[model samples]
Target chain A: MAAGSGRAVVGRQGAPLWLRKLGSMFLNVYAMAGFLYLLLPVFVIVLFSFNEPGITRDGVFRPAVRGVRNYRWGRFSIDAWKDPFKLPDLTNAFQTSLKIAALTTVIAVAIGTLMAIALVKYDFRGKGPISTFLILPLTMPEVVMGLSLLVLFVSWGIPRGFLTILIAHVMFSVSYVATTVKARLRGFEWRLEEAAADLGASPQRTFFKVTLPLITPGIFAAALLTFALSLDDFVITYLNRGPQVTTFPVQIWLTKKSGVPVQINVFATLVLIVSVSIALLGLYVQRRRERPVAD
Target chain B: MSNARSTKRWAPWALLGPGVVWLVVFFAFPLVRLLTTALDDSETTRRLGGGGIKNFTTIPKNYGEVLVRTFTYSLIATLLCIAIGYPMAYFIAMRGGRFKNALLALVVLPFFTTYLIRTIAWRVIVDQEGPLVGFLRWTGMIGDSEGLLGRPISVVFALVYNFLPFMVLPIYVSLEKIDKRLLEAGRDLFASAPRTFRKVTMRLSLPGVFAGSLLTFIPASGDFVNADLLGTDSTLMIGNIIEKNFLKEQFRPGISALSFVLMLLILGGVLLYAKLLGTEDLI
Candidate 1:
């Protein structure tokens, strides 16, 4: 009886052990493939960045395992790093991007926060429609939105220029800010404001002291997101920007169309590092907020 | 003292005022103006108005091919992104632990670069001399590099790469919202892993799946960036065509028609997505 029971146990365990091994292997393979898919383009760019003569037999940039000579050469040449500046046009574009990004962030965040507060904190007429209307740009294609703005600007005799591009960016970015801020406010407790009112503090003073302080982080987050989004904007800016008002992205577009340049890769890597750092830092903060406090 | 109530009453408006003014100036006005210009165009009126669909009929005749190609590539690229992105999202959601943040970060990191810069990166990498060609040759994957680019594959790859995060993020959000307890309950009820996933996980993840699909499909369908960056003349996207007419002073009426149709198509897709996810799932 003991031997028979032992044999039964062994038989049952053997199949699962083998199956488990196979399952784990399959998962590992899948995970590896996904990692590769995520990293492939980045890896390709980084690898090509270091590959030099950097030119192929066809006089075009190609990847070769030819070592670190290209990196050394590019690093040694300060002018190569300053190529965007040398274009004069490129420097103007960069400054234009900065100014537009700054303006768009301020305008979009302020409006979005107010709308979010109103919609989330108080009952109002036509709130649903208001929300939907705000969300309209989020769903519309960049091309459609860009073209729509272009037509509007031209028809109004507004003249396509920096101001138009800035407005268009703020329009698109405002919705995103409002959505996120409203989401953050959903977790807010209104009883604090009620308590302040009950304790003889006026609503205006209470809100200025309490409400703004609590939501400031969310406001900041929205601002950062809007700024990043505005900085990288291309479609609307491209459509609405006047001949003399090219932004960094527009300049890059023209340059790429002319032919590929290595400096763009260097610029891209820098942009990637900065933007990703900001996004990941935000995610980290969110994660920390979600964790349970230990006694 | 009474100013408190007055301030309280007007505070929300004060908050909402700047945003509303911005939108009215930038968004609403622009759209209104665009429609009027198109409708009022003498050329568009001359071509299509006299007994036809008016301004609308003129668009198709002028930009039919551009419209068709744009939708074709967008639809194709969107489908491919879903096919590629879904499995990847699933793997990350289910299997990721300590590595989840890192992996998600990788997905979003590339998007930080300007669109033009990333597209230019591909231009460098996919060129005749770029590493992709070199790697393919080294690995015996292709006999030559000439056929690899200026083709739909390169454009599709760029689109997929650029938009993959949009697809993944929405689905990841949806997937994370799924109730883990229900998953455990399925297991406790003696359901097999695959069966539980099929019955529970898949059903609940539909909203996220739909959101991701819409996010990817809308932009991908309308995108001309990849086509412009990676394609030859034969592969112009709808966006490129519309852009040509709008900016480069070519095929004016045709571009307008194509733009109008593409907008409708986009609206249709958004409505469909809303229907699938219900209106509340809209992000």
Candidate 2:
């Protein structure tokens, strides 16, 4: 049991064995509790997704009272799941979020993947400055990014709407995509392309056959991440979304003044399920690809 | 050979062109333009043009309390993250056994949910009719009218919760990198377990703590949602102020200045902390 942590020494150092056991036991319990703390809110969110608002007063259901939020169990029902698009603002905003996230993923991944491949595949002038530039956006606060972009759009006389939001999402997402793809590119074998060339394959053929397949997983992972980032974005999108546009998070913020809607949780739960599924699918594909290599 | 060499010369630029241009135009240029906007006068007469530096000059005095509170909450949240996250990270890295990947995935699970949705959940948990409020009422901590949702502690708790994974992941990476053989070497040298942890494990993980602290603090300081949803007017953060002012056209210059000042302070603080820690590689 002490093999991993090297706490095996405490027993040898005149400390009683039981004391060491108790310490390790305590450490494990603390970690378990920490995980619980981290996950509890998410659990609550899922649980309340099925909550039918307004306790069954006699036979009819009603929305919870005005001052207090509907937080009780309130009888488990799939009303939210059945009517996920019950709120117009939320549905429209969610669709817009998905659209922007999709467009942003495509553009950002294309641009960033090329950059990452170039950076890894070849050394060139201005590499250091370019890398540093990429880091700046990642480190900058979303508030700053949002405000700055808003300023830029207003000054440029560009209307703030779906286009502006797309630009903002793509702008912020590029560096993350770059960083992820770059990290993935680092572990790739450059020799394979060379080997293909030596075997009389043309450069394009070498790329398609040797490099593309090996790099797809990284690019796919980066795309998934970019999509997630774009979808979950609130601060940046809110600032740049303007009067006409709204994303899911922005909708949630706007609706906060009114009341909590069950549809928000239902959609949120759906998103969670989709993202987790995609992640698992990615993992499965990567594992399956590696299995052949292992054999 | 000449043709291939030319392709080499142009290949990197060709690939880097779109991303670089996009960042410069959309990211870098906006920030520069934001600075000018910050320096612009409060009057809408010349809203598009640059003006005097009074926005910067008056921000400190006007927003002093908010500036201080933002840093204080972020600092406290960062400290709490290290307290909670470090042990969890250490345990998982050292003792997670075969369940390591699964546990790590679980840690990242909440991130799949939208940020506002997760925050909304916290609102439910601490609202007037929630379990936490019931518990606190039972404990005689407060009356039924006094809910848990809008308080300093709730704000800080949400901050810690939101950023705890950021603290944990980096620390876990650092802890995982601690060579097991070295710990064995410490044992062979007759160092006790606690001493070994203090000297080797703790010292080696400073970089992780450094990283985790920055991750937790930077976002926590700039965070708007946790404070906005969980706390009332008295606990409103600089981010909430930034959000409000930016939305209101009359306050753009002042808010721009505030945003610029906040960015400057964060950069300065990070540099100073990194310098004090001698983590020169952080840059």
Candidate 3:
């Protein structure tokens, strides 16, 4: 205690001398600056969205001091939010995105879960090679993957549409989900399953009743992550989506081909908020469930 | 075989069936077909092979220029991510309190947002009428409309901004996993703080750095989203060329060969990175 307090005294006495503690603090400050850099453009976009002047003349967005009139309130109105179908483009895009995301998430999670189970529960030939093959898609560039899928579809005379989009999403997203579930399975004990079987449960019942509940968190994480990946996928969707099938990202990309509107800023903020909120909520729920183990 | 052996034999296959089917159909099939076409399409080979290695060569041609530009842009963006992200990762991992998870969550949240929307948003912020331009002009930094977004720097800046979290999160996880006692031990030996960091912290965190850079570089190198919205036609990356081939040009054979070559290059780099980081288990 004396030594601790004495060092505290020494530290206090040397407060004016940062030479003793220069590098660490500098690194900390440098890191914070980097954080600011990372966040600056995003925040600026959100900020500038409110700067709309309701009209553009001579290629200049006349600055309006963020009055309610300056907000594209009626154009991108709350009515559209409440009844999305009123705006056919947004509604169609939203519905398409939801359908694709939901299907992709379900397929990815189910397939990934089964693979994780087999990987953990059995020893098989070519296991190492198989695992590598499974993980390859996750790291592949989205554009390359998108182009390759497009080529195969064209070659095989498969028409590009909703089915193609969903298939492509599931193809890429399954790898991520599989890796997540497999990591969860790695440290899981087999005794619980044995105990269930010992108590007269069949293998399927044992898995459903005991093992499934334990691994559900990982499965849930996988689903949510896949949903985001599916919704956000542009490269693949851009390549394979039929002319009539425009998801939100495709719409935004097309709009970018024209001049950008400030409303895009508003929409982007909402997207960022929604995605961040869902991820955080999912993480919060998972962490709450995990607290007991951590303790 | 007996019934017991049959049941046991099919169980693992039953479990693995869906995943294997999914990969074989969507991944392996597509790659096989694309590569076969790239090497076999009569017209493509006739054109490309006549030029020998020169056709596949990554120079002189506009495609070659685009590839080089892609490498240069991604390399710059990746370096910037490391320079800007490592410190941020260190800050959140070492000194942040209960808010660390919340902050990290913020960093990753952008990943969930649509890439198209994010890139488009940057366009609005940097447009001629955008506030960024106004602020710069007001500060007398530029007198003309051709300011931030009109230049390569802004394109690189936007790429760094979008991809920075990829660089930070992996490093943050690695840093968080490091033993605190090791750092304390370094300090106990009366080494200066910088010395301790260089010898202990940086050495241990190298894996995370490699992982983060791999995550950033691979995506950024192939990314066309930022280049499209933030860059001019001259600044397009390899992804833009791929996008053009698929969409506008419809040069399937050239695009396939380009894609195949690009994949090999990226795979080689990732393998090297994994080796450097001493992690052979990378997917």
Could you say which candidate leads in lDDT?
A: 2
* Per-model TM-score of chain B: 0.84, 0.93, 0.88
Give the CA lDDT, 0 to 100, for residue B78 in model 3: 93
Model 3's TM-score against the true structure: 0.87
Off by over 4 Å in 2: A2-11, A55-62, A65-73, A292-295, B42-51, B141-145
- Model 2 in CAPRI terms: which quality? medium
Candidate 1 per-residue lDDT over residues A1-295, each given as its tens digit: 2332344345532345457558657766865775576567675555434333333445555543443222211222333355534557666777888899999888888888888998888765567877888888877789888887777666668888888887788889989999989988997998898888899999799989889999998898899889889888888788889988988888777775444445555556666777777776877887898999877
Candidate 2 C-alpha lDDT tens digits along A1-295:
3463455444565566678779878988999999998899899888888987777678877767772243556778888889888778889999999999999999999999998998898899999888888888877778988999999998999999999999999998999999999998997899999999999999999989999899887898899899999999999899987788899899888878877788888888899899789878877876786786653
Instruction: State how far residue B233 of model 2 sits from its true place (Å).
Output: 0.8
Model 3 interface RMSD, one decimal:
3.7
Q: Which stretches of candidate 1 lie over 4 Å from their true place?
A: A1-24, A44-79, A82-84, A202-204, A277-295, B1-14, B41-54, B58-62, B134-145, B248-253, B273-283
On the 0 to 100 scale, the lDDT of residue B95 in model 1 is: 67
List the candidates ranked by TM-score, beginning with the highest.
2, 3, 1
Q: Quality of candidate 3's docking, in CAPRI categories?
A: medium
**Candidate 3 lDDT tens digits, B1-283:** 6997778777778988988998898888999877765655365445644223433553336477777888888889999898888888888898777889877876776665567766655665677766678898998898865567757887898888888888999999889998988877765676545677898889888878888888889888878889877788878888988877676423666677788888888989788768866777544
Least well predicted 10-residue stretch by lDDT in candidate 1 chain A: A68-77
DockQ rank, highest first?
2, 3, 1
CA lDDT scores, all candidates in order:
0.72, 0.87, 0.75
Candidate 1 CAPRI level: acceptable
